[model samples]
Every structure is written in structure tokens, then in C-alpha cells.
Target chain A: MLRHAIALLSGGLFGSGLFISGMTDTAKVQGWLDVFGDWDPTLAFVMGGAMIPMALAWWMRSKRVTALTGEPLPPAPSKEIDTKLIVGSVLFGIGWGLAGLCPGPSIAALSYGGPGLYVFVAAMVTGMAIAPFVRARLDRAVPAE
Target chain B: MPIDWIWGLIGGLLIGTGGAVYLLGNGKIMGASGIIGGLVDGSGLNTKWERILFLLGVAVMPVVLYPLYRDVDTHITDNYWVLIAAGLLVGIGTRIANGCTSGHGVCGMSRLSVRGIVATCCYILAGGLGVILFRHILGVI
Candidate 1:
């Protein structure tokens, strides 16, 4: 119960942060990305500011074996840089540039209705659904290390 | 009105704190893509309820603040083709990469993960190229 509550609060905070920071606004996101055009630097500050607490959290993780909820800390992600990471990020970036919505903002912007919103999300989900198969093919060709 | 950097900073603090809470209390990385993506891909079945609850919180916050944020607009393109194409790329890209802005940008960078940093660079560069191609060159989106 406590774990669930904490998850809820964390997610709520994240969602609220996205909303308050104007991340839910696709224009703002596109504006930030539009450096050659009229760029908005607000997202830089958001990214910078967001790193503060998270950096501290990592420090805390280094010192503690267990979490506040008494759960063991999850393992850190692998350090290997691979083709999938680069290609996938590039693909994702193109989408983000085109639509100005990443995973978090896309989900957070759910209530902020627009016809394009649902369509974008549905297509995103479909892409996700098909990713495993695509990945399998890619792996067969060039085996991810 | 254009958003101020001050609000971005403030909201960023909240976002960071939220990540901290999830990390320190829940003992997990709060990658939005991975959280929801895993559920869709069937890898997160063991933690289904937790994922759902977290998503509920994410989805509900706007409604809770709807009174204050009544005029919020995403300004996304009305073109269905653009929307679908963009969405598909985002979905496939993030999944194949194994992270997104939240996972790689926020969580991974904070910890100085090499993969996170590399992925971030790749995406930002590609995004810039994409903007140039789609918006400036082709004038599609």
C-alpha cells in the first residue's frame, strides 16, 4: 500500500511538473527544439533544474542499500552503447521534432484534449506494439551487444 | 503567453523531486516510456497494478488542476498524417532505444550513465536534423 501510494505521488508530481513547466504544450516543446528558427530556452532550465534532485537521489542510492519502502534498489542500467540505442534515439527524435511530444508529455497531456492527441497516442502505441518484432529482425541482422 | 524559465525551473524541481521519490522510496527508475511500454509489451505484467496506478496519477493530475489550467493547449498539428507518422516514430524509436526523454534524458543523465548520455546526444541531434528536414526543407510539418 505504501509503495503504491509513493508511486502515485511520484507520478503525480512528474505530471504536475510537466504541466506547470509548459512541457505539455507542443508549441513550447517545438519552440525549444527550433533552434535555427525562434528558439525557447525554457526547457534547458527545466532540464538543468530537474537534474539537481535526481543527482542527489543517485548520491543517496550510492550510500543506501534499501529504499524508504524497504525495497532493494534496482540495478543500474547497462553501460554499453549500441546500434539500437543510437538508431532508436534518432528515430524517436525525428518524431519528437515533428510532433513535439515525448513519452512523458504525451501521457501527461491526455486531459488536454485535441483531435490530434488521441491519434498521436494511438499511433505511438501501435509503433510500440510492433517494436519487438522490428527489434527481433534488427537483432537477427546485427545482434545487439 | 510564452512560458517563463522560472516556472520551468520550478516545475523541473518538482519533476526531479518526483524522480527522487520514486528512486529513493519505490526503488525504481521512473521512466515513463519504460513504465507504460513494458505493460504494453507484456514484460511488466508482474508489476501491472503498480504501473497502472502510476499512470493513473500521471493522467489524473491535469484533471485535478484543470480549474487552474483550463486554457492549456498543446498546439499539436491538426494534420492526421503528421500526427500518425510522428507518433509511430516516437513509439518505435523509444522502444528500440530502450528509453526516451524521461528515461534517458532525466533519469539516465542524472546518474551519468554512458548509454543515457549517448542516447540523449543521438536523439537531440536527430531531432534537430528532423526539424530541418521536415520543417525547414520540406515544409511538411
Candidate 2:
């Protein structure tokens, strides 16, 4: 029960923050990406701002094996920077730059974004649904990592 | 509009607090893409209720919060096909990379994960390039 509540609260806080910060504003995101065009630096500030507390959390995490709730923290992240990771990030960046809607803002902004958001989100979910099959095929074609 | 650094920082602190909640309470990263992506890819059923509640928390906020900033412009492009392509790409790419902005950029980078740093660099560069190609050269919005 506590865990669930925490997750819910976390999501709520995350959504509220994004909305409050105006990260849901697609124009602002696009502007930040628009280095050649008239650019906006608000997104950079948002990231920098987020980094402060998160870095502190990580510092706390570094010394501990279990989370505050007594659950074991997940293993250390993988160090590999393979082709799949690069290719995937590149693809994601293109889409993000194209639309200026990432998963967080898109999800959080759904209540106010009108009908088109549903279409975008549905297509995104479909792509996610198909990912396991795609991964399986790739695994067969590519050697072990 | 000009940069709004103060709000940006305040909002970011809130976001980080949410992340801290997830890390400390749930022992998980608070990444939107990863949370939902796990469910879609069929690996998150074990925590289905948690994910659902989290999404509900996210999906329900605008009702209460939208009034605060009626002037902000959320310029989701009017072009539908572009929206479709963008959505599909975001889904696949985040899954493939094992993270998106939240997972890699904010959460992972905070932990000093190399993968997160590399992925952030890749996506930021790619995003910048995309803006140049699509917005400048091709004149697409």
C-alpha cells in the first residue's frame, strides 16, 4: 500500500512539475531544439534544476543496497554503449525533435491536449506493443552482446 | 516567449522530488517511457496496478492544474501524419535504448551511469540535427 501510494504521488508530482514548468509546451521544446533558429533555454534550465535533487538522491543511493522502503535497489546500470542503444536514441531524438512531445509531457498533457494526442499516444502504444517481437528478431539476427 | 528560469527550476525540483520518491520508495527509476514501455512489452504485469496508478496520477493532473497556466502554448503540430510517425519512433527508440529523457537524461545521469550519459548525448545531438533538417531545410513544422 505504501509503495503504491508513493508511486502515485511520484507520478502526480512529476506530471504537476512538467505542467507547471511549461515543458508540456511543444513550442518551447521545439524552440530549445532549434539551435539555428531563435532558441529558448528554459528546457536546459529545467534539466539543470532537476539534476540537483536527483544527484543528491543518487549520492544517497550510492551508499545503500536497499531503498528506503526496504526493497533492494536494482542492480547497477549496464556500461555497454552498443549499436542498439545508439540507434534507438537517434530514432527517439528524431521523433522528439519532429513533434517536441516526449513520453512524459505527452502523457501528462493528455487531459488538456485534445483529440490529436489520443492518436499520437495510441500509435506510440502500438509501437511499444510490437517491440518484443522486433527485439526477438533482432536477437536472432545479431550475435550475443 | 523569453526564458522563464525560475518556474523552470521550481518545476524541475518538483520533478526531481518525484524521482526521489520512486527511487527511495519503489526502488525503481521514475521514467515515463520505461514504466509504460515495460507494460506494453509484457514484462511489467507483475506491477500492473502500480503502473496503472502512476499513469492515472499523470493523466488526471491537468484537470486540476491546467487552470493555473492557461496562457502557455502547447503547440502540438496540426499535422496528423507527422504525429503518427513521431509517436511510433518515440516508442521504438525508447524501448531499444532502454531509456528516454527521464530514464536516461534525468534519472540515469543523476546516478552517473555511462549508458545514460551516452544516450543523452546521442538523443540531444540527434534531436538538434532533426530540428535543423526538418524545420530549417524541409520547412516542416
Candidate 3:
């Protein structure tokens, strides 16, 4: 119960931060991405400011075995820099630039976002729904490492 | 109304703190794409209820704080097909790659994770090039 509450608080804080920073605004995101055409640097600050506390958290967690909730920490980070990551990132960037809504903001913006946002999320979820099948099929064809 | 860098910084800090809270207290990564992506891709099946509750918590923030963003226009493109295409790409790409801005860009970079940095770079570069292509060359922003 306590862990769940913490999760809720964390998630809520995240959502509020996204909203307060104007991340939920689609134009703000595209404006930041538009480096060549009237660039907006506000979003950059958002990332910069966010990094400070997060870095500290990582440093602190290195000393601990479990979280405040007694749950184990996440697994070690992956060191591999493979092709799938790059290709997928490239694909995601195109979509982000096109629509200006990444997953975090997309979910939060569902409240007041118009029909366009609705369609985008629906399509995104649909895409997600099929990803496992694709991965499974790929695994069967070629044993993953 | 244009360059609110200070607010961005403030919000980013809050965002980071939120992530920190989740990480330190819940022992979880506050990665939006990873959290939601895992659910759709079968990776988070063992923790579905937690995921659902986390998402509900996220979704409710906007509703509760609607007053702040009441005037904000999300600026979603007017084109429905375009929206669909964008959404599909975000979904498939993030799942296949395993991260997004929050996952790899923010939290990932904070930890100095090579995967996070690389993924973030790829998407940022791609998004920039994409803007140049669609918005500049094709005039289809």
C-alpha cells in the first residue's frame, strides 16, 4: 500500500512537471525541435534542470540495496549500442517532430487534447499492441542475444 | 508567452524530483515510454496493476491541474492521418528501441547510461533532420 502511494505521488509529480514545463503543449515541443526555423530553447532547460536531481538520485542509490519501499532496484543498465536502438530512435524522432507529443506528454494531454491527439494515441497504442508479436516472430527466426 | 526558460527549468527540476522520488522510494525508473511500452509489449504483465495505477496517477495530474494548462493549446496537427502516422511511429520506435525522452533522454542521461545517451542523440538528430525535411523542404509541418 505504501509503495503504491509512492508510485502515485511520483507519477503525479511527473505529470505535473510535464504540464508545468509546458511539455504537454505540442507546439512547445516542436518549437524546441525546430532548430533551424525559429527555435525555442525552453525545452532544453527542462532537460537540463531535470538532470540535476536525477543524477543525485543515481549517486545516492549506489549505496543502497533496496528502495524506501524495500523493493529491489532496477537492473543494471545495458551497455550495448546496437542497430535496433538507433533505427528505432530515428523513427521515434520523426514521429515526435511531426506530432510534438512523446509518450509522457501524450498521456497527460489526453484531458484537453482534441480529436487529433486522440487519434495519435490510439494509433500509438495499436502500434504498441503489435510490437510483441513482431518481437516474438523475430526471436523465432533468429535467436536473440 | 514565448520563451519561458525559467519555467522550463523549474518544471524540469520538478520532473527530475518526481523521477527521483520514484527511483529512491519505489525502486523504479520513472520512464514514461518504458512503463507504458512494457505493458503493451507483454514485458510488464507481472506488474500490470502497478502500471495501471501509475498511469492513472499520471493521467490525473492534468485533470487536477487543469487550471494551469487551461489556456494551453496542445497544438496537435490538424491532419488526422498525419497524427496517426506520428503516433504509430512513436509507439513502434520507442518499444523497439526501449526508451523515449523521459526514459533515455532525461533519466538515462542522468545516470550516464551509454544506451540512454545514444538513443537520445539518435532521436534528437532524427527529429532535427525530420523538421528540416518535412517543415523546410516539403512545407508540411
The lDDT leader among the candidates is 1
Quality of candidate 3's docking, in CAPRI categories?
A: high
lDDT of 2 by residue, A23-99 (tens): 88888888999989989898888898888888888888878888867888878889987777888899999999999
Best by DockQ: 1
Per-candidate TM equals 0.96, 0.96, 0.94
Clash pairs (backbone) in predicted model 1: none
Worst window of 10 by summed lDDT in candidate 3 chain A: A135-144
Error of 1 at A135 (Å): 1.0
For candidate 3 chain B, the 10 contiguous residues with the lowest summed lDDT are B67-76
Alpha-carbon runs more than 4 Å astray in model 2: none
- For candidate 1, give the docking quality class from DockQ: high
**What fraction of the correct interface contacts does each predicted structure contain?**
0.84, 0.77, 0.82
Segments of candidate 3 deviating more than 4 angstroms:
A136-145
lDDT of 1 by residue, A73-116 (tens): 97877878878888899999999999999988888888775778
Interface Cα RMSD in Å, per prediction: 1.0, 1.1, 1.1
lDDT of predicted model 3: 0.86
DockQ comparisons of all candidates to the true complex: 0.83, 0.80, 0.80
The TM-score of predicted model 3 comes to: 0.94
As a whole number from 0 to 100, the lDDT of residue B5 in candidate 3 is 83
